[model samples]
Target: MTDTQQQSPQARATARIIAPVRHGLTQAGALAVLAGLIWPAQAACIAWVISGWAAGDTALGRTALGAGLFALGGLLRAALDARAGALLFEAADRTIARERAALIEREIRAPGPESSAAVAALAVQKLPMLQPWITRYHVAMTRTRVLPLVFLVLAFSQSWAVGLVLLVAGPLIPLFMALVGMAAEQASRRQLDEIGGMNDMLMDRLSALLDLRLLGAADRAAQDFRDRAEALRDRTMAVLRIAFLSSTVLELFAALGVAMVAVFVGFSLLGEIGFGTWGGQMTLAQGLFLLLIAPEYFQPLRDLAAAWHDRAAGISVVAELDALDAADRVALIGTGAATAPLDGPLSVDLHGAAALPGRAVPLPSLQLRAGEALALTGPSGVGKTTTLAAVAGLVPLAEGRVMVCGQPLDADTADAWRARLAWLPQVPHFPDVTLADFLDPRGTGADPWAALDLVQARHIVDRLPDGLETRLGESGGGVSGGEARRLMLARAVASGGDLILADEPTADLDSETAAQIVAALTGLRDQGRTLLVATHDPALAKALDREIAL
Candidate 1:
């Protein structure tokens, strides 16, 4: 199956759409308010039925009608409570979504070589696990633990004898659920971690498919995936086993609590015990009322075991996501603090730039006059790209700074400083639109043919069916090596007129084409535009007024 198809159903359900909604009220507060409202409504029905029936003038038919209306009100209250529970569930889901978006953005903007694999795992694998837990577990915990206690207290205000037994037995449901479900929580947490790790490993193997095939290691990769899949299956089964046992245990106790209440009522009716001795003795309807409401109070207990299990899994995910966000915040600040601005003479200072992450090789300082052409000579992978990155303000520098036009530039907002400087990297990215649209962000009329001609790329454009109007095919997907490089140079020159930083601008072209491109570049130099070219070709390096070696 494709990766998208392989995504767990749980992940799809909780897929983050936007920022998460914040948690507004504590579970305790909500339970208190809900239970308070329920108490009055429940009590009013009891008094209405009992008091009306006590009057001798009330007919049997009238009593039954009054009872049915009271039951109808109870049904409406039940529906209202369900709606309130759903509102809280959606709020919790929103909160989780917002948190995930913020974390993902932080990770993307982070500096240097920070791997986002761990962060992605938490967002995709762990965040979904928390969704159901947030909704269902929260509801269960409140209804099982807090609502029962609130009802028991209100029951006491009506009748002390009936209230006493409720107070004693109500707590047993939660106590038993907790004791039995403890192991389930631990198991679910372990299973969740295993699932996240497996997800990471699977993604890694897939991304490295080309490398594994080239190195003849496909079998090893397959075996590794198989082992991880087996481990995930084992851990998942362990979690399910514990979950089933805990749920079964909690259900048994809930049923037993109901049975105990029934026994007390039966004995009280027979007068085997005093009315106040065991539980209150009253009419069949009164006894039936307490019996009916007792199980409803603890109904949330039946799901307690599963709720705790899910909660443990969810906490594990939130903790991991928070850590990733913390790390990203640190990286963003670290990149901003390492800008070093170099000084030049009386004219425009073409100061050197350095990016964060260590310099792979030494880059000598550069100073240039308005008319001078400087060449940076180095083999591949020597700090040449790093130098360009520093100048562009993309990477954080370990040491040194870039000063331009005789003024020290702010390293933090390098792009603002670069607005006047032309830059062409080894590989440049362009949009999917036509060449003219790519060059003009503000929709200014730009002659694509003229720009390509200046960069010696006119013939390539003319050969296309649409010429200047032809699309670059999204980040230059269909362009040949030489065409992409030359088009990049055209973009930089078209975009900015002053200083140009060209990395291997002529490396992929024919000798005649290279010469023509060099001639065009020299015209810019003669026109007082400063140029810095990182090249290994001795012929091209020697063509410059000055050269620097790594």
Candidate 2:
């Protein structure tokens, strides 16, 4: 089997995402483990100085040498730790930046914004949790793997009794930590899921704030938020409890190990016990060295226990990344890049096209020449919007091809073809830009006033706080649905494209407003702009030259 296939699922996923950024990780982990190894030498220096004093051989130079060695080891260990931390954090920063950029870049051109909130949560909050895992947990694990064994060897060399106590206790700490880590991983996974759900709820609620207020459901929305908050709080607390429990278990075993070692070393030095030692005797130096080494033997275990939760959380986050990366969704074609308009006559043809993933819905072959106004009239769920998007190059086809401007549409031609099209979607969306910019989104130098006048939306802009300078967004900035439709028509007029695609533009508008929208669209046809409208409104469809009902 390949390396990743041999590992557990979470570990496989975690390693796949993290291994790419692990350039200096090995060196960093080596540095951290080396820092831990320094303690044994420092402990030796202390033991030497104490042994000299106990034997009445405390010459000034010998004592100074021991003190100097201890100080130098401390400084060297500190430097190693600091360098390792810098490398690890740098790697962590790179990893987060790379993942966040990839997620945003992939989602920006999607046909639907349905998962934007959850993706935002993943980008902003969940992805950063991997940082501590890379920086702390891995280093701790490396030290645990090496330092305990080194200390065990040193302890056995001095006295087997002390080594025996550590040998029994160290294994149990890791065994218990392994068990606790399972629960930790489960809790962390739930917490991450809760966080995504929370963001999704908040975004959905904010988008429908106006409707909720009008429907007298604001209190109900507030209650929903409170409930989600409570659930998140519970999930967070569950993780914290598991972390605290693991630490408590580690400390209990660590204390017992150290205590047993201390008692054995102390009694051996006092001549109360002699059988546990190799020489049947213990000197002050040996007793002191073993005592100093006792706590240090469990040091790596302590560090590992402390960072076990981070490993769990990091694995959960990586699994999340894997899920998002593997998820198969219907995304738009093209780089969504700005391009010069495709150079061709305005024409559209669909050859047995169907929406992505499957071809259950039949989209028959059709042809439309320049300056034609065709309506795709159909009931809901008849793939009207899908056909419009397919023609616009915003949705990919599974079984057939779309020709735009006499060119077969693919990634190579989608952006350029889209440059020549104007899409006025069912629910109007505006960026947080000035009204003038929104009117001329492509910066075609088209007169905003003229476009507004053509659509009869000039009166709507006159009521705005800043006229053409006013900023608005998807909520329409207090503009009603009909007004928003008129404004979008104005934008389409300003964009100065050859083909206009209007989707349910008058679906919820009143009779007068719908009539005005229909008039503006017919006016566009009079201007020789080809119109492909997806609509259920009979009057608007009848106004066009021909209709194709799906």
Candidate 3:
């Protein structure tokens, strides 16, 4: 039967809880079971040698045979364990990569701006915590479930009393562990939240450090950051103390259980207690074998106790990832289609379009033919950008159908429609790479320097140390606002999109730059590209072919 077909309900639930590590868990369990089966043979061989010594029958041939069997079992167990560890590590690495990629894709496709700082924390910092859970804790859990039962049945066949003691003590370990785990779960979740908050705080403060310093509040900001770090440290130490205490309690129970089995075997050999071995006295070899296997029976439980904290952390990480993937937030624009180039200039139509669900304003229906240039003019907070976003399909429409190239905009065609258009957001972002690479990632476009020359941004590139080869930081850190705006314009011209959407493209530019932008818009209009610009600039408004006041 297939593995999925053979899985019990409990195993299926576990697989769901840690779906990424299911394959690793199955392979590890099979290896551990093989090792557990070999353990008994190793123990019996040792007992046989000891009993022969006790009987003064130390024949070299029998002794050598037992020694060889013990050695072979030990080597097999070690090899199986090594293989299981390697398999789990690879599985964990792949799982983390897959989760990080999925989170990024979801964020990029989401309708509006998201908390990127929080998403970074989840991907870069929190996601890797699953490694130990899959590699160590998962293996321990599988062994704890499998090896103990195997040892118990073996013990029962020899002496039911020893098996009964293990059976009683085994359940108590998990009982105590569950109680400790409950507290750990709460503490772990708090730690994760605080860490995410700390990351967001650090990013925000760093971005606005100049403003804080100018306002003479830098010292206060520093103090606040210090306080947060100290609080996080204290929380971490508290969790560690609880973890150590739980480990101590579990060890005490495991040690006591093993000691009790040793005492019972000792008494049986001494003829003090003689009522539990199938109405027959145990041979010295049988008693010795039982005693040797006693500690092996509890080893799996001890390993599990050591990995309990990993379980807590892993479950929390999975919960965070699930929250990221849930559709409780705003919807994204498109299906998972690769964007394609437009065949020609396209018309845009907004029928009964309105701002997203919570807004009070309803947008007027409008139609623009191919190659027309229109400007949306409105007061501040009058939904100019919202209208542009609605047109771009970047925000959900409350009661509207947007059509481009005579086809209605839906998830199925959104990506292809977006591909046909170029967007210049009010706030632009550039990846951390050389300027030439940022403008043309595929290295298949027109000369970036030539495009920069068209928008009067060539000087900005020439002034840099490496010219077009100079690397930029996040959000184009080295460039001024005007320079960034011009770069966006340059990129749009180079992209050759049939439709263009520019939001406040001339807001931060000087008069000379504004004139250059006007000329560029004129050139794009003459070339028959449809243009929609959202602006408060009267100069830019006069330059457009038509204006729509919202």
User: Which candidate comes out best when scored by lDDT?
Assistant: 2
lDDT for each of the candidates?
0.63, 0.86, 0.80
**Compared to the true structure, candidate 1 yields what TM-score?**
0.60
User: What tens-digit string does per-residue lDDT give for candidate 2 at 1-550?
Assistant: 8776578866685566558866678789899888988998999999999999989997999899999999999999999999999999999888889888887877766523336789889889998998888888878888888999999999999888788888998899989999999999999999999999999999989877878998999999999999999999999999999999889889999999988888887787788886787885888888888889889889888888878888889889888876676666667788888999999787888976566543446675678888899999877778888788778887777777888778899989999998888889888888988898889888766679998988888899999889989887667977888899899888887888888989998987899989989999999899898998999999999999999999
lDDT-based ranking: 2, 3, 1
Worst 10 residues of 3 by lDDT: 8-17
Q: In model 3, state the lDDT of residue 270.
A: 94
lDDT (Cα, tens digit) per residue for candidate 3, span 1-550:
8795477533543564567568767897789778877988998999999899999988998899999999999999999988887888888888888878878877776622336687898889888987877787877888888888989998999999988988888788888888998788778878888888888898888867867998999999999899989988987877797799898888888788888888888899999998778778877988988888888888888888778888787777776765555444566577646567534448788876554533435675678887889999987667788777777777767676888778877777777877777788777788777788777743575688766776678888888889878887767778887788888877886776677899988876789877777788777788787889999898889998899998
- Candidate 3, residue 50: the lDDT equals 89
In model 1, state the lDDT of residue 12.
Answer: 32
- Candidate RMSDs in Å, in order, are 9.8, 6.1, 6.5
Please provide, for model 1 over 12-40, each residue's C-alpha lDDT reduced to its tens digit, 9 standing for 90 to 100. Answer: 32343211332332443364346435644
Off by over 4 Å in 3: 1-15, 18-24, 50-67, 90-102, 111-114, 136-138, 153-168, 200-210, 261-288, 321-327, 334-391, 398-417, 423-493, 498-550
Pairs with steric clashes in candidate 3:
none
TM-score, candidate number 3:
0.70
Q: Taking the candidates one at a time, how many backbone clashes does each contain? A: 14, 0, 0
